[model samples]
Target: MPNFPNIILFAIPFFILAMLVELFVTAKQHIKSYEMKDSFSSLTMGLGNVLLGFVSKALVLWAFLYVYDHFRLATIPIIWWSFVLIFFADDISYYWFHRVSHTCRLFWASHVVHHSSKHYNLSTALRQTWSGSFYSFIFWIWMPLLGFHPAMIMLQMSISLLYQFWIHTETIDKMPKWFEAIMNTPSHHRVHHGSNPLYLDRNHAGILIIWDKIFGTFQLELKDEKVVYGLVKNINTFNPIKIAFIEWIYLFKDVLTGKKSIKNRILYLIKPPGWSHDGTGKISNDLRNEWLIKKKTYDTK
Candidate 1:
């Protein structure tokens, strides 16, 4: 079983190369985007993630090892087949992790960094969360406890994450029907990143599309409607600190200001990102209206 560091070392180069290819393609298509604004923030957040992975993943692996040692579960030899199973299992775990990350205030604080970019490109893929490893790892710990080795779990997670990187692009409009139906493709991911009403919280598949379909969170991209990327109330600031913690701060502020009961306060945190106390301004609806009006004008053109 390869260590997490080794897996990262092998994957980072591939990721970089793939991102470069995506950038070249995006440039050729004349897409307007930003890859380097607040780069230091991305670097710092990435460094923080490395540290968190070391501490949290180590502890989780230790706990899993303890359980495995105590139960004396038959140690399966690492093989190609095990890798395939681990890949699928890791993806399944990620689907839940991502869904919860959006739904939970504590997790959303970390997850919001990735969505801060209004432009969806390969660079957006590198705009990762600094604090996501904390809550996100819980979803995958079950894999190791269920008898898969910690190293195998980590490898599968790495591969699954690597596979998702390509799906962050707008360059590839869609894939073959069967591939798009089974796997998370660029079209599916674009919807996930879109702020459009129909796209909100949709297509949360990690590797397989089945989870989103089964859970009824799946949404197809409408050709007539263009995607407006980023959050409802866009975080205009470039500060990574604000980008990461803004929602958490806002959630706390909402709880403090509102006369709502504890249940409602809790709901504010767990509800979709733009759900307001008075229901005055819904980002999803505003975006939907904006999209509809734009579509109307384009049709006239």
Candidate 2:
């Protein structure tokens, strides 16, 4: 139970400075990167997330400590190599957690807050989920049981979070070829934020892009088709409270008011977003396939 300094807290000044710089640069390039209302909403959500973390983090720490105390396979020392191992372990865990969040309605209810903003900029990085911390930590609980110290696991998680923040902007385009191939850059992450059919549910990387490449979830950002940020059906509001909880409201409304059977109601909760029991709703794969087919037909013509 070693003490780990709150890396994210220490980085707040850097976050603000980076966003200010991005605001100035994007304006210079005539890019409408930040709308005042949207950016303000994002900042508010980030503040709420930080405040909620006080309660949620305690539960997460308790869970990790419980696993470490009762079930750890071996005690991993806090050596330099342990940091490297945890970096990968925590990242892969993040990949799955993020992937599941996109595919499953329950998790997506919380994660949708991040995608609610229609604009992609450094501020969008601050558009975090206020509720994700409560249950998302479950994805990392296995690390503690695997004998990695809780403090080390948490530190690596923060590092991954920090690494991801910069990739949220449009200021930097592609990185060097080798770096782009291995790491998640702005180009890769732009696709993740896009509402475009081909980009949906793709590139669920933390620090490395290799996981998406290996898992067949990678979609390169297309020069011809520019990335359109936000959800497939945009909420179109800047109200922070609405942005934070709208998806959950929609999810429960569907589950509770539908005339479908109990099984279908359960499916509403567990199935992917845009999943309808009647086979009418289109998920990411459905949209991507339709796009691919249309592209193929056009190419042939």
Candidate 3:
């Protein structure tokens, strides 16, 4: 993939320019969207992510190529139609990768950094994961093994990442309903960032929103309930290291000293986030199910 991070580096200037334009337009329209500190923190996270990608991306490429070299089932050719096929294939890989990131605490430790930001804007999209590059690529190993070249897989992954950049915004509320139905829009992404009971882990699409619909993880943005951004328990620090690695630290701490058996302690890493042996922390589905019952009872009352 010719060092895809270097390829994305070319887009950095354009990304900044787009963010500036968004900021300017929102300011002119009298919208209260970007906060100075939060935006700066998001930028720091982006910078860290890009820098970390330089070292970690090679491992992903190496693993994918190794699989393609030895174990490819069928040689998928690189062509125009191949890109179309891989587009959906790659997006399906992304859908499951993103879904697992939400459900499994091991991955969520890295994935949660992206959600640490309280503000959702162009900059928030840049607030990606420093550690995500390490583990998330495991989900795509099957693509290369299925006969897709590592280079092609990397290309599609980068394309999906690029496609997702613009969707992290509050300025463009909803695209045409049809567009929103098929593609991931800012509206869909905003819900992914939301901490609300109904919205938590609801929209995990990378490029196409169809995966979420098919997988039953999709949630519509309701006019009655405005989306509230950030995690239910917000990490109020802007320190990049804390934002990026705090979850890892917490995960280890729980596993090491939570007064549980060795099996349950180890399970802390494998189980869903907020899972507790003592019945304290709640998973996203648990919270959403409770919210639905309450809403139903209130309506009938």
Instruction: Identify the candidate with maximal lDDT.
Output: 2
For model 3, residues 4-76, the per-residue Cα lDDT tens digits are 3445788899899999999998999887789998898889999998888877887888999899889989998
- Residues 1-301, candidate 1: write the lDDT tens digits: 4545646556677766876787677688887654577444554555556666778666766766776666544665578788777777888788888887766666777788887778887657767775666557778756665678877776677677777778888889889999998999999999999877778778889889999999988989989658888886688876767776777778789877758888878777777666666777454446656767987798899
lDDT of 3 at 187: 87
Tell me the tens digit of each residue's lDDT in model 2 across 184-301. 9999999999999989999999999999999999989999989999999999999999998999999999899958999999999889999998899999889989999999999999
lDDT of each: 0.75, 0.93, 0.89
Q: Candidate 2: global Cα-lDDT?
A: 0.93
RMSD of 3: 1.5
| Number of residue pairs clashing in candidate 3, backbone atoms closer than 3 angstroms, sequence gap of 3 or more or interchain | 0
TM-score of 1: 0.82
Candidate 2 vs candidate 3: the TM-score winner is: 2
Give the lDDT of residue 110 in candidate 2: 95
Order of the predicted models by TM-score, top scorer first? 2, 3, 1
**CA lDDT, candidate 3, residue 294:** 99
Cα RMSD of predicted structure 1? 3.9
All candidates: CA RMSD (Å): 3.9, 0.9, 1.5
